[model samples]
Target chain A: MTEKEIQVREKQEVQQAGEPTKPERYFVPPVDIYETDEDVTVLADMPGVAKDGVEVRLEDDTLTIKGTKGGNGGEGERVLLREFESGHYLRRFTIAEIIDQAKIEATMVDGVLTLKLPKVEPAKPRKIVVQGG
Target chain B: MAIIRFTDRPLFRNPWADFERMRREFDALFQGLTGEYPRQVGGTVYPALNISEDADHLYVRAEIPGVKAADLDISVEGDTLTISGERATGPAEQRFSYHRREIECGRFSRAITLPTRVNPDQVGAGFVNGVLTIILPKAETAKPRKIEIKTQ
Candidate 1:
């Protein structure tokens, strides 16, 4: 079979799985990506998500975020005017080679997710010394 | 008059009648003191607020843990500032039968009056770590100026 035929077969299998043919729904939080001298910082807004509920994983070259938000329950008649429904959130990003995967650190505070991705040693700046004869 | 004659008199009277009347009266008094009645008795609670000040600016930080940037509305009129937002609740039909809920959710609005005049054009707002930081810079005239000292 040709390469195109193999690609078509894979697409058919994915469609049959009853899953979204396109990428998963992006729970793109309002993320601020900033870089300092030592590392790059990623600040993500993941409200109602506890520290224990958040899951950050890196596989191959992809980084993924997954979490669940618990519902609110009370023993009274509720007249809800507006609702912000929460569900399992998933987001993945393809990482670049400049990232030092081993040195990555993640912390969750007040439902915000902060990831610090340090650049590789070779990617960091270094000063050269001059010698006068 | 319609009941001019005593037809039948009960041998015993309901003693709890007086107690029930007292309970109702107490409830009414409590409601009156609170302004709004029962329906408004229990609602969403507001989070704690922290404010800091420096020579250049005043920083107001609110602990709004579950609100998103898109859901938030911030407005400043003169010296009055308001921040309002709604938090995301979980999915429909995904109900929790019994669980301890500590985090606050629902619509919240907070207003603050500034101590000094602020430069509205230079005001900055940022949300990080589930805390909203609003920076209000002092007006040029309100800011402290360094006076030149002449050697006599």
Candidate 2:
């Protein structure tokens, strides 16, 4: 085939890690975290998760992200090829004290969750001008 | 006596990289010990796919997170269905540093040879919540037909 074939990867199920209180299978959603001067942003890929199904929580220094996938195929659909399995998502991160928890903002778009943690104002550097005597 | 001042500055190296590397090592070790890892081939593809079918239509679903519908292109030729698209990178800023970078962003194209023949003109596709679904209606020749029993 001249065209490059997209590889198939099965989602890794979350096992022996952060077991949810509810009895449901979960997968570790892949994430990307980048830091700018003002804030540190986190982008997580939670496919099939709608805006109403995702939840973000910050307790102490741990940031937790959880998302529930809606559903797979339509009614009475037969499976021909099952490379990917649908499941809920769960992941946690240890945030630093420099982040201003009060100003953290999160948004979901197209099954991707973006969390922006702005830096505390006091932590930013300030310039001091000197007056010549 | 001199005092050393500490400031809340970003680390030079990404801390998450260590965690990821260690996790991969652990996974490899466990896979070697048990020889029963679900995904024998590690890492990931551009877009993972799942194919299902109904009586009339064959559905092909792909998970392409962070991809916009406008950036995707789907074409069908004969028995081959191709999904090609570019996943744009995060905000364009040279000053930004990354703690964890796992998302793959670039031009990606995947072509699949459908299990059965489909009507090229009737193919329909939709994108929602980072998932792209293409519904390919089976050709008339491919659908099952029933014949009434003739009695003497």
TM-score of the A-chain for all models: 0.63, 0.79
Model 2: DockQ score? 0.36
* lDDT (Cα atoms) of all candidates against the true structure: 0.57, 0.80
Clash pairs, candidate 1, are none
Tens digit of per-residue lDDT, candidate 2, span B1-152? 86645555554759787887687678656754662223323335556667778889999988888888898999999999998887787788588888898666677887789999999999999888988899999999888778899999
- lDDT at A93, model 2: 92
- Every candidate's DockQ is 0.04, 0.36
Candidate 2 B-chain TM-score = 0.69
Write down the TM-score of every candidate: 0.39, 0.76
**In terms of docking quality, how is candidate 1 classified?**
incorrect
| Model 1 collision count | 0
- How much is the lDDT of residue A56 in candidate 1? 82
- List candidate 1 segments past 4 Å from native: A1-133, B1-45, B93-96
